[model samples]
Target: MVWAIRGATTVSNNDADEILTETQNLLKEMAQKNGLAEDDIISIIFTVTKDLDAAFPAIAARNIGWTSTALMCMNEIDVPGSLKKCIRIMMHVNSDKDKKDIKHVYLNGAKVLRPDLT
Candidate 1:
């Protein structure tokens, strides 16, 4: 079966290093929580808030040896008064676990985006 794991995190700043670091942390947590391996991942789609443009979140996955996994980056639709410096990911993976067993992670200021899941 295929599952789409959701995760999000916020960077303290708009700097490239901050974005990469936070994204890596979010990915690591998601993978650990879901028992995911690079081979199990089908793809990952990342979206960043309008305020973030220093780097692409997908680079964090590549830096962690997920080079074979398909990845894409996009901008989230700007909403007035929304959280800033946020990076969200939807990772598709092949898993035997039921959907209800999947864990969705939200960290930093992005936690507000999915308080129920967090």
Candidate 2:
């Protein structure tokens, strides 16, 4: 079976190190919580708010040795009241777990994006 896991986190500022670190942390948490292995990952799509342009969140995946995994990054739509400096990820992976058992991660300021999950 295949499933999609969602996660999001915010950087303190538009700094490359901060973006990379926070994104890496979020990705690690998502994988850890879901018991995901790199071989099972299909693809990962990362979206950052317009305010976060210091670096591409995909680099964080690469830094963690996800060299062969499909990864992409883009900017989120500039909605008037949306969160700023936020990075969101949608990861598709092969999993045997039931949908309801999947764990979605929300960290930092992005926790507000999903009150129930946080």
Candidate 3:
């Protein structure tokens, strides 16, 4: 079955290094939590708030050896009062795990986006 895993994390600033580091961390956590292998991943879509335009979150995945993965990045809707410097990811994967057993990850200031999941 195909399952989707969600994750989000915040960067301290709009620096490329900061964005890359935080996104890499979030991806690692999501993979670890879901017991996901690169071959299991179908695609990854990343969205970043307007404040975080320093880099593309997909680059972080590539830096971590996800060269062949289908990855894309876009700007998140600029909602009023929404969290800033946040990078969010939705990863689709082929997994046999039950839906209820899937784990979603939210880190740093992005935890507020899904308090119950966090």
Clashes of each: 0, 0, 0
For every candidate in turn, the CA RMSD to the true structure comes to 0.7, 0.6, 0.6
TM-score of 3: 0.98
User: Weakest 10 consecutive residues, lDDT, candidate 2?
Assistant: 48-57
Candidate 2: lDDT over CA atoms? 0.95
TM-score of 1: 0.97
Clashing pairs in 2: none
Two-way TM-score contest, 1 vs 3, winner? 3
lDDT of each: 0.94, 0.95, 0.94
lDDT of each residue in 1-118, candidate 1, tens digit only:
9999999999888899999999999999999999988999999999999989999899999999998999999999898988888899999999999989999999998889898987
Tens digits of per-residue lDDT, candidate 3, 13-46, equal: 8999999999999999999999998999999999
Question: lDDT by residue for model 2 over 1-118, one digit each (tens)?
Answer: 9999999999888999999999999999999999988998999999999988889999999999999999999989999999988999999999999999999999999999999998
TM-score of 2: 0.98
